[model samples]
Target: MLLLWILLILYAIFLAPGSGRDEIFHALIRGDFADVEPLVVTIFSFLGVFPLLFAAILLPDRRSGSWPFVLLSMGTGAFSLLPYFYLRGRFKGLEKIVTPVWLMRVASSRSFIGIIVALFILSLLPLTGGISLNAYKDAFMHSSLVSVMTVDFLILVPLSWYAMKRFRGIPSPISFIPIIGPALLLWQQRGEKDNERTE
Candidate 1:
């Protein structure tokens, strides 16, 4: 779960500057990027993917220790993977075959439902007021939003697919975590050691 939470934090960071939040602030409130830059947007935009991909790499499977934690992490991370999934389904031939399956899995998961609820709640934040939805609409037109969203889609789709593959009995050597595929390899190694010890 910690791993998954980390991803959510990153997602929030990356989504902030490019998403409706920053756009509305810039347009309506005339908030300057310089003011928000140091604390939030810019740094997050660059490094936000680390925690999520990190957690996903570090996180163990559901059967290992606490299943709920694993589920929660996967769910949250899955939400973070939304952009990736969208793009993969569009560009990758492999995803074209897998998209329906992925979609079905998403529809069945409680985590996906939670994301919807959370986004709804986030919009209600006092600072967000009521115009956030409008801002979100505007965010689509911005170049930053498109760039970030595209990158997000590419990274997340494979991660989600790998997770699904892991669940469905296909053992994958690849981990969804960015800049750290080795973590999954290490986990696999550890899993083998544990199994050998039991044997």
Candidate 2:
């Protein structure tokens, strides 16, 4: 994971293509999506959702010491998270600490998962009218922000799956489906807990 993070940083700095990166970045910052491709906008929005999902998975584990990385990931995406996973692997026996009961409840609650699903659906709405893959590709090739963000999203997919498996204990097949998969896995767990309580 450390090596992958290093390679990603090197690629983003030295190899990713895009000359109008500054302009695209400014436009996104200013909420100027009129000229940006819907696909790009959608991907950018999902970048935000990805961090929340990770927080849900990692915070409840308590032993991962993942809070700092999870917070940083809100802005840096996988750049912040890969390190947490790397450290977690290296220090598997880190003493478990007591996370706040409320924080843990919020992170593990169905309500929080519902918010994630809603945000993901809202982000996808931009692409409802159809998008041009070629146009998105052109933008990606010409915009460093877009290209790096795309790579970040790709990296998060497997990390999310692995985090779910490692922390949650079972690799739900649905987790391989990206945001929706993890959300579903959490939702299923919540449902199982409810059933257990009822019984």
Candidate 3:
């Protein structure tokens, strides 16, 4: 994890300034970047996906008030990933933490995973939609919201995915089937490790 932190800090120092939280905030609240893109408002809405899905994955074995951190992550970006790392030591490992009754109810629902999956598809639709996809390609090259969402998507989702894999003790390497894998893990009532513990 030391190498991960080093790379994180270095990347933030060098690359984040160009497409950091402040830019996302300004573009979101005031339409600061309206003239530059296919659509800034649409981008702003989709931007929240990184945090929302991330929170859903992390909340199962964690305490209450995780929602606020998820809300904050929209502008704070990587700041959200910090708190959970601190909590990992406290609970002896996230997998073994005490899951709340309410959280279990939420996690056990297959429909919830379906919803998250649908939203994910909807979220990326703008970027992946034909002409817009080509436009996003240009923006990605020049570094617009493409860069911001790309960085946030890269950072948060994989972190959540790794945590899920470790928590579930999934040795399958490809534990998740790409888009819905994390959602499935999040929605799991009793994961592989959970089942082992129960037995």
What TM-score would every model get versus the actual structure? 0.26, 0.92, 0.58
In the range 1-199, model 3's lDDT, one tens digit per residue, is 4455556666655664344344444554564544445443345454555565555555554553354455577676555665655456565545554556776556445555677777767655544433456655565555544565556556665666676666545444443344456665555644554577789
Better of 2 and 3 by TM-score: 2
Can you write out model 1's per-residue Cα lDDT over 30-109, one digit (the tens) per residue?
A: 53533332222322232333333323332333222222222343434344343333343354543223323344444334
lDDT by residue (tens digit), candidate 2, 1-199 = 9999999999899999887436778888999987788999999999999999987887876556787788899999999999878887577554454456677778888899999999999999889878999988998888899989999999999989999999888687778787988988888888898899999
Q: Which regions in candidate 2 have their CA more than 4 angstroms from the true location?
A: 92-98
TM-score of candidate 1 against the unseen true structure: 0.26
**What are the RMSD figures for all models against the true structure?**
15.5, 1.8, 5.9
Residue pairs clashing in model 3 are none
True-structure lDDT of candidate 2: 0.86
List lDDT for all candidates, in order.
0.40, 0.86, 0.55
> lDDT at 28 for candidate 1?
26
Candidate with top lDDT is 2
- Winner on TM-score between 1 and 2 is 2
Question: Could you tell which candidate, 2 or 3, scores higher by lDDT?
Answer: 2
Residue 143 in candidate 2, Cα distance off native in Å:
0.9
